[model samples]
Target: MLRLPKYLWFVRMKVNKIVELKTLYSFEAPVFDAHGTAGTSQSAELKNKLDLNSYLAPFPGETYLVKVSGESMINEGIYDGDILVVNKRDRPVDGKVVIASLNGEMAVKTYRDIHGVIYLFSANDKFLPIEIKPFWEFEIQGVVKHVIHAV
Candidate 1:
């Protein structure tokens, strides 16, 4: 018996509502070296104000945030409850993670083009690659630029 991938059984894009960030916050914080051993942070000094808006989304009008709700992309460092920064105006390139609509369903997957054939791949092995057919209604919504998650 040939067993299919788990994603084939039920593949649905779990995403929260599209949100527009109207405010940009800037704060001053000390930068620490992760490679160095942790002992005391009293020696570290703050240099500049870190602006999240400039670092994450340079163009706020073309960017939006979406919360993930699945473990399919865990291998790619995208986990459930992580917030994804999507750029609507950015083009989806090969090997890049993108937000796409297939057959009227939205999903976040890695985009790939092999020999003219488009395939959406999941970072986790449990889910199989999804081949995009000509008959399916497909559209690339945006390209994911950054993923925000708590430590």
Candidate 2:
């Protein structure tokens, strides 16, 4: 019942090479409190450089980014054009979002195992859960570690 995007693509990231921390750009920025008073502006200085590679992909060799395009997972805050940080080395836990291949097509969905039957669920209520059949070509490519979307 999931609606896949017309064109889905995966971009494999090569993060195996080690880069010197000093060579990376320093991106320190002020942090603001979202829950602060409406008129009050409170900012705090961050002491450390924001190394995206280290923060987002600790296990660089096994991590990759996949751009998603669909409304099926909107409720989970995964909208079209969102980038999913996936770790192939991570095990797919129950209720975790994962990148999966079904019948040679790629899709992202919450993984669940109920009574030993695997099911893929969409965050949006409009779509129904997909139950995996024994004969279907299915494989879990990686577990989604983080979802990056522009505000």
Runs in model 1 deviating more than 4 A are 1-9, 24-35, 39-42
Q: What is the TM-score of each predicted model, taking all chains together?
A: 0.83, 0.75
Candidate No. with top TM-score: 1
lDDT scores of the candidates, listed in order: 0.80, 0.71
Clashes of each: 0, 0
lDDT of 1 by residue, 21-123 (tens): 5555664454543443578554544455666677788888898998888878998999989999999999889999999877656788999999999998988
For model 2, the superposed segments whose C-alpha errors exceed 4 Å read 1-39
lDDT string for model 2 (13-130, tens) is 2122222222244444444435556666665445555556667777777887888777888888988878888888887789999888776677888999999999888888777787
